[model samples]
Target chain A: MKHFAAALAVSAALAVPAFAQDGETKVIGVSIPAATHGWAGGMNYFAQATVERLEKVYPNLDFVLTTASDPAKQVNDIEDMVAARHVNALVVLPFESEPLTGPVQNAKASGAWITVVDRGLSVEGIEDLYVAGDNPGFGRESGEYVASALPEGGKIVVLRGIPTTIDNERVEGFQKAIEGKNIEILGMEHGNWNRDDSFAVMQDFLSKYPQIDAVWASDDDMAVGVLAAIEAAGRKDIRFVLGGAGMKEMVKRVMDKDTMIPADVTYPPAMIATAIELTAVGLVSSAPVSGKFIIGSVLITPENAEGYYFPDSPF
Target chain B: MKSPKIQMSVVGPVLALVVLLVLGASLNPSFLAWDNVTNVLARSAFIGIIAVGMTFVITAGGLDLSVGSMAAFIAGLMILVMNSALPSLGVGIPIVLLGMAVALAAGLVAGCLNGILISRLGIEAFIVTLGSMGIYRSLVTWLADGGTLSLDFGLRTFYQPVYYGGLFGVSWPIIVFALVVIVGEIAMRSTAFGRHCAAIGSNDQVAKYSSVKVARVRLTTYVVLGLLVGVATILYVPRLGSASPATGLLWELEAIAAVIIGGTMLRGGFGRVWGTVIGVLILSLIGNILNLTDLVSPYLNGAIQGAIIVLAVILQRDTRQGQ
Candidate 1:
């Protein structure tokens, strides 16, 4: 099975050139957030890596990648790409939802194929394709793991990410998954998806409560902070830390099956790579990629950890 | 007259802290716990230490938007240097000491660079530091490849003590923060250089006429700011055992906020070291209070924090005017 998977990846990588014969070179514009924080950094990494791979596979395809620190700049960037770059297809992960909607709508109006990654624009149906990781599933998967791990129903706490619609959905799904179970949630607080903030919040959790069976740090960066806090406090009661987003370091721990971090959930920053690849394929071929591509959150355990691990990838 | 300025500088924040403490304790009894209080203080050390340097800069009529990125860059460099040293040096006392030295030196250099650009070259401090912020942030990102620069596992356990260790009952960070505050207070309040800084900040032409060597005084303050940032980074790196380019994000603003909240003027000519310490405590306590009470939705956390800062500044203004 492992060999089959490797073979599949190799063939899929090689298949892009063979699949694209659109007669002329097509320019693809990719816009994503600059490397301001960990996840975006990873997104930027994967976006560049995927572009490199695709460019080699399909020499006739040209790519223009633009990273913006803010929404207004991103709008200006997208406008420039559409007007001057003469982009045949546009792939964007918006800095924010609402502000980018009208700009994206204008980009769409220019007749370029639109593929939006990660964040969805406020106005729906603006893009020809939408690609995102399952945030609610990410929360639910984490909750379900804890539920089964502690079948006797023990007390647990949660450290949420920044309060966004995504954060709300993740928390809602988490609460929904753990409802009526033997688990008692001791407390929940926002870590703002930051390592330092998570460390502080975890410290408070440890001090406030005497015993906590487990902790769900919704993002891996926060989980790193949570683990540090637990170690510093010298508390052995926390059975495992469940952190999502498949950061390389955390996933490596899961691969090694570190008792402190036994598992992780996937909300990959590389989904941008996936969106770009699919968009490129669509632009080259008659592939029907107009629908939403919702990437499922997979529970990364010790058994299948190597497949998810990317030692070279930044995230 | 002395008492009035003290009232303007220190009393308001002290009172604010006392009222906040009472409110926090009433809202949640755990907010006043000894362990939690130390935790908040230890965590605040990063901002508190950097704000000390910022006090000098602001008091010298300068601002550094690059301190946050500078801290991140320094920490990242320290970790990389330490990690590279581990293979040959081993994770012993020497390696740890070497890492600390590298951190301080990096901080000094980064600070000097900022100082020279702003003071000697006559560039606006704001623009220079702003450009340096991008440079430092990007340099770290390039070094980490947009991921994390983690220390060697062998060194992690040995060096964790710097942050978690204590002298007596106080956490190491709290002790360090106190020492920084004490030394900073003396340097800013009782020394000739302190007066020169105030003089330069008050009026450069007047200071020049008074033989203050305005540029030299300004340059030294930036160096002080950078050195303090280095000190903060040394404490910060151990807590997480790694440094990301994202480390110290927006810390410059936080440090400045603490300085202003502590009653330092934005336009310069005043240095309030102890007041800045109080400002750090107030902000730290507010975060603690927020964490303890979960009733405030996390979505409103930023809004609530902003409101409190505005309220504290308003109260300070009213007190200063009355004084």
Candidate 2:
């Protein structure tokens, strides 16, 4: 009698309606950083917005957005999202490189096409398509801009972001560019990508160094903190305070040609959008779309600041 | 009551600060600049403000994890209110006062939620605020649509004067932080609530039997904490054009660090507002010096922060044992 009842229940479960998209559901999974910071918040916004738009455009494609605030949660999320059998393709912006390798590999092994954005994975042959902004380029361009403007190479104090791979890459790239030049990096400290932390860091930079020709505030958010501290100090020695990452306010400063902010580095948040588009085109079109994808990092100065400016969209 | 204990508390942190300076200057002479000293005090204001509150909660036998997210939520709300009213009210004194009032009220509500849930509901303050931390953070993310809501361009200059403008050659945030310390000191010293607070921390059941309204004390303390956070946000918002989800990330940790390092007992028995001020300053100074000198790699900065926090706690332990 129990066996008979179990059989009946299995039949009933099979009869339930499918949750997948109607025409021919091709599951697409999205993994992004949890909406912890403003940038990640915008990243989540773009991911969700694009998923909605894509579902409307393609009847067969169903998208699932998963957000994790930290590295471990992201790894677990990838595992859970993959195990649900809800995806034919996966797009991930990893929280950290080391911990996410196995999960991305597992999802790829399960026959899902893969794309990794922003932070890269440690596992090779995992990401079928990769989309990313150039950190080295971010550092090089900002460094080059500094070199050109300060021909004689003034004393520069650098305020770094949190100690991550991205931070290391940016600093390495920057140092490489300024090598053998007159430019001296007076000091460097990690502001941990926090505004108040950066403010304190910049303040110490000012005090520890009697004369500073300029400042490189690696990220725009940190730049805000650095600028506040500098302004509070009321020092005139800083001819320029450089910031990167194409934040809206930083872009605005570039447009206004604020004496302190003459240029910026672009690390567009729309890379997720780019990854989605490429993945969709691969599924929909006859063209070969499976390959490594690289997006150019353009330097934004007074001339091109307006083009990169998005007054409505939050960065 | 004023004895060798008070003087001992004063001597240790001062020695630590002086030693840190000596070490910093020896490593890099540029560390003694006027600008840097000013910078450390200025940036330490935020952590200092929150730590002052944590000093109360911890001494009172409670902890608050909601501060980081609560501060961000209040900042976002303050900005939204300020921007909405900018057009209706002129850029005169009234709008500024009104904006500050709204910010403070928002903080009180947030704090009240914390106080009510823990004190009244009999829930652990840590777990209660931790849940609220997620809730408040998510709410702001939803409100912002995961982006930033900056001040409208027209009102940027009008609003900026609050942060940029100074009285007596001191930044507004610094001045506000100072007043918070003074008020916190007075409240914890002169008020009836103050005496009761100590008795409660020392022995909750005993204090309860002594006719101290235990629940009311705990609840009101949170509200006061909320008010201070709100005030900090008010002074802080003008410096930044927008409020995003990252507004107060890890501030709870920093504030806790300041409290722990400031000689406040984490297990709940004592809170020292002035010790917290010095603690915040010392913590802030480390970050400043690190930025000024390339003595250590940037990656090791966290190690430095962790080490300093441990050192402060150890010194406190030593002092306690000696007493």
Candidate 3:
């Protein structure tokens, strides 16, 4: 155990000198939530791809990637990686906003430039760069797209994500966009952003409502299950189904002209990769990068689904 | 024949199902529709199978927390396997059968490990499977590199038919679930091993003296449970065309709930295969009925599920201890 720690320390030390001289070998620390579901899983994928591409393009650079299932663990992980990997700069897609703020602040305090992705802290301005997909847009776009298609005001069921500010923001935005629209929401329930859970929730919704015009499954994983349950019941009244997070399967559905999946809402996982790239560039290139990088969530209609489709991406 | 406890055991769950149906229909007239009723049964298949295996585990006085994650892991691995084979094999029926066989073997091994650790090594079943649960979940996540294990379109139709098809008027999942119930019932009744399982669960010391192979039975139950989880995976993965760690999150609790609510003792002695089947159906039915209704809030759906499960269980507990 002692030898393992020492080896990590030595390698970290060896890599630091190389990084300091050129600023080219700047260490990129990629912290993402563990793969409990599809979205985070895809984020990890892009994080990895970004690391390899940056390393090959910039020979002096190195990448250190880690994951945590929750905010508390992520804080501890940051301390561990900074010590063992000699991360010169940090890129974090936190598990939660508030619990992670202190740890991120500490990393920033120690001279590492910070790039925060997705979730934002309740306390602001600690991060040197902030990158996120607009959550409100996720809700509003999905609500607008689906509601527009059902102009006659059809009944719809909604499966929500976990109770977080992001979840709430999306819900609020969606509800607002569809406000005064003909859509009567049959019910809204938390599927906790999962396929099987959504399947259960959708099954319940199907039994509860005699007639439903559509479904807005807030997230892709839930969208997968809701569509499955709907198909099993052979319900045609569910004119279209839409979900946020450009999961490859959902994107593919739109691309293939599947009538039920007329469109999708984009909450791309690649934003983390984008964050890491910006942080890496900030260290070496002397580029003027000060503003918050808010990636727009575009509605993926059939005409635009090909642009969002990633045949190679596991998500 | 033997004072009819067995027949009553079977009848209890059926009676509960009828009550649920009546209550559901009374709450909303649409619940009785053939489409809604059939949909609830079809959606219940995953838990039905897991609960069946859990019926054996709990009745044998053991627990397996890894069942859900094990199901997800096997599903992910099977999809990965199928995806790899599709390019080479050109998306045929034979490849799917081969994939199923491999996934079943992996699940059986996982179960056997849980069994041997608990029964032979004398480890607590809870702790053993709890530890195995983390390991299995981590393995699947690592294997997929934290991404979805989607079946590409080339072979989707070839394999999709299993979850999508119906036998007579029933869904394929329901058909598979009924087959599991039948096999489980026969195993519990006619097999020497089945009698020994009951004897051991009732009293291991007494069972040992009575020439029951206590260790063998306990060890094998895990494998049986594992195989059932594998079967559940075969039906499950195609539903979404992918598997993640959340695939079977907290499912063991559901399966244990089904077994206990079905009136099986948590200790090692009793089995209620048919009761467990209905128990699973009731769980799905509660969720379905709640969603279909114009409930004040969807959050109530969980509270309702929890309430019904607790009520069913308390009712079973009171009745069992009555005589």
Best by DockQ: 3
lDDT of 3 by residue, B102-179 (tens): 789988898889989999999998899999999988888877767767777667667777887777777788899889
In order, how many clashes per candidate? 1, 2, 15
Highest-scoring model, lDDT: 1
- Model 3 C-alpha RMSD to native: 4.1
Give the least accurate 10-residue stretch of model 3 chain B, judged by summed lDDT: B314-323
Q: How big is the positional error of residue B64 in model 1, measured in Å on the Cα after superposition? A: 1.2
Off by over 4 Å in 3: A1-26, A57-61, A82-88, A151-153, A203-211, B1-19, B87-92, B189-191, B319-323
Residue pairs of candidate 2 with colliding backbone atoms:
A34-A68, A208-B30
Q: Give the chain A TM-score for each candidate.
A: 0.92, 0.90, 0.91
TM-score, every prediction = 0.93, 0.90, 0.88
Query: True-contact fraction for model 3?
Result: 0.85
Q: lDDT score, residue B271, model 2?
A: 73
Off by over 4 Å in 2: A1-23, B1-10, B21-34, B153-156, B318-323
Query: lDDT by residue for model 1 over B1-323, one digit each (tens)?
Result: 45455454456777787888898889887777877888889999999999999999999999999999999999899999999988899989999889889988988899999999998999999999999999999888878877888888769888888999988778888898899999989998899998998888888899999998898889899888888888898898888888887789999999999999888888898889988888888888877777777768766777877877777777678545643
Ranking by TM-score: 1, 2, 3
The 0-to-1 C-alpha lDDT of every candidate, in the order given, reads: 0.87, 0.78, 0.81
Across A1-315, the per-residue lDDT of candidate 2 in tens digits comes to 232244334433332333332335566788888766656655665676676666556655656677887889888888888888557889999888889998899898888889999888887778889899898888888888888889987899888877778888888989998887899987777777767668767767666666999998978888888887778667899998888778887899999989888888887887888898788777766777777877767889999999888765667
Scored against the native two-chain complex, candidate 1 gets a DockQ of 0.58
On TM-score, who's better, 1 or 2? Answer: 1
